[model samples]
Target chain A: MTYRTGTEAFIQGVRTLIPLTPGVIPFGLVTGVMAIEMGMSPGMSMGMTVLFYSGSAQLVALQLLQNGAVPVAVVVTALIINLRFIMYSASLAPYLHHLPRRWTWPVSYMLSDQSYALCAVKFSSGELGRFAPHFYAGTAGAMWLTWQLSVLAGVYLGASIPQTWSLSFAVPLSFLALLVPNIRGAASLGAAVVGGLIAVFAVTLPYNLGLVTASVGGVIAGLLIESIRKKALSNASTNDVEREAQ
Target chain B: MSDLSLWGMFLAVGIGTFVMRLSFVEIYGRWRIPTLLSRALVYVPPSVLASLVLPAVVYPHGQGAFVFDNPQIPAAIVAAWIAWKTRSTVLTLALGMAVLWGVKVIAS
Candidate 1:
């Protein structure tokens, strides 16, 4: 629970992130391949990769562009997909707010779902103490390096990778791995079920709006279930007290 | 889209995303997060991830149509089970890809 120094905590963070890199590598490779297949030059593809630093959003934008969608639509949809970062930013703010701008700015820019997931619980538990930011930086730095290098490899190896490999499926598979761990309680379970079903039923929506809708629906479902469970618990306690009075 | 236009779009998205990422961190002490919004934030990862995973699996091509015989559904189910049991990302991905390739071969 304690570390000798920030360097030790940072190394620990990097070590923990190593296991998740397997899930990340294929997704990054697929993104790189898809961008090239869509006729983007290697320089342009890397430019998008470095700029976006988001695999899913970048992939979605590339798909939209390949379909000849308007430039405005591509930009909007990508931004919408990146909306979850705002939630991550808010969640992490309390833990990281005290750091100076030099530390906070780059750390914010490097935030990703993987790093946030790793750090959120650690930060909340107050286990890392003063070295928490260093640990976070370690995870984010490793993830950034892993992603950029894998995508670069994919770009160079593009077209030669056979379609029969079905690498795109790896994207969902990795998400499943991440999703299973996040379902820690009934509330989170409700959120996942509602979100997934809505997405399944709303796949026909334009501009990939179904994703946004499904996410909102799922969060609301979770909140509703959580409040209901809380009320039931309170009522049961009150009834117990009344019986004791009798 | 032309090269210039494509770059412009990327820049727009990149800047927008950066702002969102910095939104709360930049103003953290200035404004407190409301209790309700903070509570809702806990569900964001599960809901958003499930939203992405389900659609991608059910509609393998990102097309709206759903098919009962899709290999991805079963592959995903198996992978989910493995992930739950093992909690190993490497193992889950490796087995999931293996299952998908096996199913495709058998179906053909």
Candidate 2:
């Protein structure tokens, strides 16, 4: 894509992110409050908003810190929690690999769950062109800005919010909202079941290593099932071909 | 409790997170990962999300013990069903919070 065309793609990407803002806003608000409750300053919270830019990881880190976990522990926990971003980055690489290094760095930095979702939708729909990275940059940039602002709002308001309302449930509820529909296939079911059991059993692991282990275990189970399924299908096809020859 | 220390922690987290994210791009460009590794990546999100959510659902405190005495369990279960049925983040959260608060008030 030409420079002029890429510029348009960037604008298109920013537009797609607008609808996602409302969903991100409340999550960020919760993260900011959680940080404050954990004894972190507003500046520190906002810095996390800008830098980490991940609501789930930020919330998990805050809780870990509150538990008096060491810095290494907190960081490792967040990394394990966010390991999926590597997959997201890899998925988008084909679309964005040719972009300038400066372009790739910031765009990758801004990538998150919602932005990646939007990008995937656009890319699959054929709406995205060679300048798709520009579009992604726009979507991610908007999300990043809105996410930071929402956290800042929460930091200012979290301390004053009444305790009568239970906001803590919002976190798990959000995940439930995201997770339930995804448990569609046998692969997903196997993964979730194995992962859940492992997490419950390994909760005592320091720095939430149970999370990493459970995730690895779940992924392994899912992949194994899928591979077996593929192999079975291939074998059946070969047997059919032999019968036809007879 | 120290302000400077908190900022230091924030910086550490922020920098650490960035470096971790950057690793996927920097390393993967030169080295190709196996197909099994790629397939495993797909399950990471669900497992990680479950790990994050289960702890909060089962134990509000950092402890390993379950809080069956608390109402958060029923509230969360109801909310989980709502989430599954409607697939709406806002509604699920709102319902869960309302139930949790209502239970807390009645119990207390």
Candidate 3:
């Protein structure tokens, strides 16, 4: 409600993401556990965290890399998985386009699913001006810190976790937590079912191309179904109007 | 997939993803995103997460085909339901992990 400094905006941003902290912690731990379990060198695995900073893409790359996929495929999958950020950035661009290059670079680097979600709503609320970038930086920084620390803890605890525990299942469980709430309608449900089925069916494709195929197929299905539903709803309303007129 | 190649994947993906993020931040309002692309982006999270989720829970890595053989499948089903109902990530994790461990003990 009041004009805020960059530091204040940053603090405010971190505050907004506090409730989501528990959700983020497990995913980071799962990523760290997977990196160690995959037999990656500790430094290399940590390097992946620092370099990629994305749990989904990191997990995807880890699985494919262990599967002996090519470098190009692995990189492409990571990039493809992160394509949503481009859209997020586009939406955020209007609020932050005026920022200096020095500020914009770091802000872009820290973009993630959680930060984008939190900031997108905030930015669109018209509360931000030049200080908006600071708020985003705050959310991203909090997430970055939590993720790295959790990964480190997981890496340190990698040996003692015990194999029988089936801890790796947490990765998918985390993803399920992320996905379940988003299934608001048939389009999303169609997207999930079709995309998941296609991923399995096309598993034999070389270089992890099946994953890419599934991503594209699922998005297309969701979008198509969404449009169809919209059309159906409009048509139904039109019919209702005609009946009322008679 | 070699050690050296792992580094390559890291560097390549790191740079590629960074550039993707920068594409919009740097361009900002100058370049417009197409309507189709905007619409498609909304579905990306569900699609990407679903693709990842199904494989991890069902096929896993070593398992052959997805049957009731893997403990993760049932645990994930319960987790999915918990997530749907409570919509709490912590509960889903705690309960899901508990279910998974319980199954492991009993199945053995």
- Provide per-model DockQ scores: 0.57, 0.47, 0.58
Q: Which stretches of candidate 2 lie over 4 Å from their true place?
A: A1-4, A124-127, A231-246, B1-9, B23-29
**Model 3: per-residue lDDT, tens digit, B1-108?**
478877877888888888888887788767899987877777787888898788777786632366666878788999999999999888999999998888888998
Which ten contiguous residues of candidate 1 chain A have the minimum total lDDT? A237-246
Q: Candidate 2's residue-wise lDDT over B18-75, tens digit each?
A: 6655555655577665666667767666666676677767877756887667787888
lDDT of 3 by residue, A1-246 (tens): 434587888898898878888888877778888889888877988999989988888987877766677788888878888887788888888877788888888888888888988888768887666677888898988888888898887777776677767777777788899889867767888888889988878777877778789989999998888777767778465553222111
Candidate with best DockQ:
3
Candidate ranking (lDDT, best to worst):
1, 3, 2
Candidate 2 residue pairs in clash (backbone atoms < 3 Å): none
| Tens digits of per-residue lDDT for model 2, A73-157 | 6777777767767767766666776766787787777878888888776665656666777788888888888988888888998
Superposed Cα deviation of residue A100, candidate 3 (Å): 1.3
Separately for all candidates shown, the number of backbone clashes (residues 3 or more apart, or on different chains) is 0, 0, 0
- Top model by lDDT, which number? 1
lDDT of 3: 0.81
lDDT of 1: 0.83
Q: What share of the true interface contacts does candidate 2 keep?
A: 0.52
Winner on lDDT between 2 and 3 is: 3
How far is B49's C-alpha from truth in model 2 (Å)?
Answer: 1.5
Please give each candidate's TM-score.
Answer: 0.82, 0.86, 0.91
